[model samples]
Target: MMITEALRLQSQGSKHLHFLIDVNDEQIIYSNQSFINQFSDIKNPAALLPYIENEDLKYVMEKYLACKSGEKVEDFESRVYIDGKRHVYKIAAALLIISTGQHIVGCDAEDITDLKDYINVLNEHNKKKNSILNIVSHDLMGPIGIIQSLSGLLNDPEKKTDEQRLYQYIDLINRTSKKCIALIRNFINQEFLESSGVSVVKKKSN
Candidate 1:
């Protein structure tokens, strides 16, 4: 009756995986429908260790052991593979003691794979945006600085530049301006391709 009530109260037609285990025997006392459906092969709590990703296996095991040792286990997220597909789960567990002096560990696991993936996508996009801004700032500064320097030289009253030299500086500024325009176009194109999930191969040009 205790197991049944606990399962009903925790699961109650929820999609979250729920299970109860005998802490002493490390055996599954009961598993809700969602738990059974999601992990049909997981006979006991110990059996879940193999499914957890190697990097997260130790942390998850630590939490489980803490819960079994009568310690309050805080909720945590872990990555695991289910049927060859990677999934992230937010796990929470509590220890329950029945009237018979038996210790039961009740666990709840909520799948958050989609949420993690979305967050990862947003992070990648943010990184790309910052990278684009840095590259544009660095590349665009060179030609602009050259134009400014040439304009300063032309406007200087102390030094008289000959007509030929003046024409040379003006031609150089025109070429630099055109180069700046080309650079802007390239950056815009690259940003568009990246945002659209297209691969970009960077090449060097004069």
Candidate 2:
């Protein structure tokens, strides 16, 4: 016996939210226990539109319509509200033809809220690291340029005519070097504090 797409997907994962909709009347003909429990006896897919995030509603609706029109939809992520709490789902849909030659749209949605949250945390960490690198690069250039100019003067005999002037140049270079050190230390400290606030743990393995 050949298994239909809807049946195959339904058998694949028990935790997934699975449903089948009649393409003609757009009625939800079949729904798994998980879907009925989460959505509470919704008549059709359109009934769940209000629970989808506003920003994602348009895109999700487009995909839904495409599935209804017999188009295969790739996996897409969207945030939805279930029981007044936000959840992320990776959704996919495909056209299913029954033995009677009737067309149906098979949809499978997986809960991926935890995975999305983890990815977001990693992205935020990368943004913070990039910000620190940009600031350190911009802030250190000025002091480093000053030190280079002063060191060039000390190396040239023509620019070192007077002892007092030479000593002043050396002092300025010292102060500029200290400023660079302070800038580095301050940024390092801030980065350390920010990294400490993250939930990630560093483990060293030999």
Candidate 3:
């Protein structure tokens, strides 16, 4: 929007960028000071296209065209490159009409680069944590299930029929107990390894 009054200058502050385009004349009418200071090269919509990411450009243009048809676009997130650095922006566009019945599209954009970076890091951490949980649930269950099944036989007097069967069950239980202990150690060591710098070391084979 054009700075016709004193209040207009105060409205466009340094926090966000604002620009206006004349829908009737198909020209960029005005750009706020913050917009000009940051995007000095982008004077018009055509000049701004190259800086917009492919997907973001498509979405923003769709919203811009919608605004021409008297539709409002709000919280439209888009990626734009300013001096080779990518930045996320929350944009809103709306159709505006002054007393003269002149149609204009008012677009407001707020930089949200820091917020987007923080969300991406959180998503990556969630993925790694889920992978560790899967190993604990599936891999460790095998030895535990074997030990539980043999434990029942060892406890039952009727199931422990002969000397040979007794030795077999005892040996199986011993080996399963060792396997379970190793799994527990590995799980604990892995947790400490990622959080700090401590982990279990496997014995080297000759």
lDDT leader: 1
lDDT of predicted model 1: 0.84
lDDT per residue as tens, model 2, 1-206: 35677766655446888888888778888888888778877876678889999999889988877877778897898999977899999998999998988889988899988777777766888898998899899889988998998888789877654888889988999998999999989998988887875655322110
Pull out the clashing pairs in model 3: none
Report per-prediction Cα RMSD to one decimal: 6.7, 4.1, 8.0
Best by TM-score: 1
lDDT of 1 by residue, 63-114 (tens): 8889888887656999989899999999889999989999999888899887
Count steric clashes of candidate 1: 0
Supply every candidate's count of residue pairs whose N, Cα or C atoms clash at under 3 angstroms. Answer: 0, 0, 0
For candidate 2, give the lDDT. Answer: 0.83
State in Å the error of residue 95, model 1.
1.1
Higher-scoring candidate on TM-score, 2 or 3: 2
**What C-alpha lDDT values do all the predictions have?**
0.84, 0.83, 0.78
